[model samples]
Target: MVATTGRGRQGRGRQKIEMKPIQKETARQVCFSKRCAGVFKKASELSVLCGAEIAVLAFSPSSKPFSYGHPSVESILERFFGSSADAAPATPPRHPPAAVLIQALGRQEKELQERLEAGKRRKAALEESLRGPQWGPVGDLLGAWRS
Candidate 1:
């Protein structure tokens, strides 16, 4: 049997990285470029596979903006905001007047706000669960455990 040296294969495998800001500017730029490309690729794949509209905006270390959007960024933004500048004025309203449209939009906004609040609550509960139990005293723990 041949003796094996631990050092031989140790550095060749993947290692868990500590989550922290990269110090060197060059390394940070390289990492940013690679990660940005990877994210954009994933976004593209998700859009294609799920038929979902997507828009991604990112800023580099130098404060330059990068964006990717399916079916054009401007079109997506217009759709999201429910406004379009180039829309033909000659086209007759399929629905009613501006007041009805405004009312409908208000209702939609309210519904979206309610959903947002619910999602925030859910997120907070999940975060609390992940943090485990927090007890000030034995009484608190017992009270929580019992109920």
Candidate 2:
């Protein structure tokens, strides 16, 4: 036998909640926690999907603060405030610090050089193998094969 309740098999799915203040303190705190989590999740998604930098600051009914940020709140706040300060540069830097960039470029250059040397060594070994008495040159080997 199929089980059925007065409200149907599954009670009213999701219902639209009225947007207003919750009177109960415990309920309001719960709601605040849940909503803050949801807001943070959306902020994270926005940051990942659109590469957006976002910082969220929220205060609960009790006056406690909640915060969210892409990268870090401090960094975002620094960038925001630093850009406005009189002593700060007219424009924020477009790239990483010069020393960091130089180090990264140096590592990449070294890796590329290593790859080049390895490729040269491979080519030399292959050429040496092909010069054996049985093989002769690549052109001659192809010619002999075709015949």
Error of 2 at 104 (Å): 14
Candidate 1 clashes between residue pairs 3 or more apart in a chain or in different chains: none
Misplaced by over 4 Å in model 1 are 1-13, 83-147
User: For residues 67-135, what per-residue lDDT tens digits would candidate 2 score against the true structure?
Assistant: 998777877787778845656533354458989999999999999999999999999999988786654
Q: Model 1 compared with the native: what TM-score?
A: 0.47
lDDT of 1 by residue, 1-147 (tens): 344567654333455689899999999999999999999999999888886677888999988898888755665666666656666433243349999889999999999999999999999999987787665588597998999
C-alpha lDDT (0 to 100) for residue 85 of candidate 2: 60
Reference-based lDDT, residue 64, model 1: 88
Q: Whole-model lDDT, candidate 2?
A: 0.84
Each model's C-alpha lDDT? 0.80, 0.84
Output candidate 1 Cα RMSD: 19.7
Spell out the clash pairs found in candidate 2. none
Q: How far is each candidate from the true structure, as Cα RMSD in Å? A: 19.7, 10.3
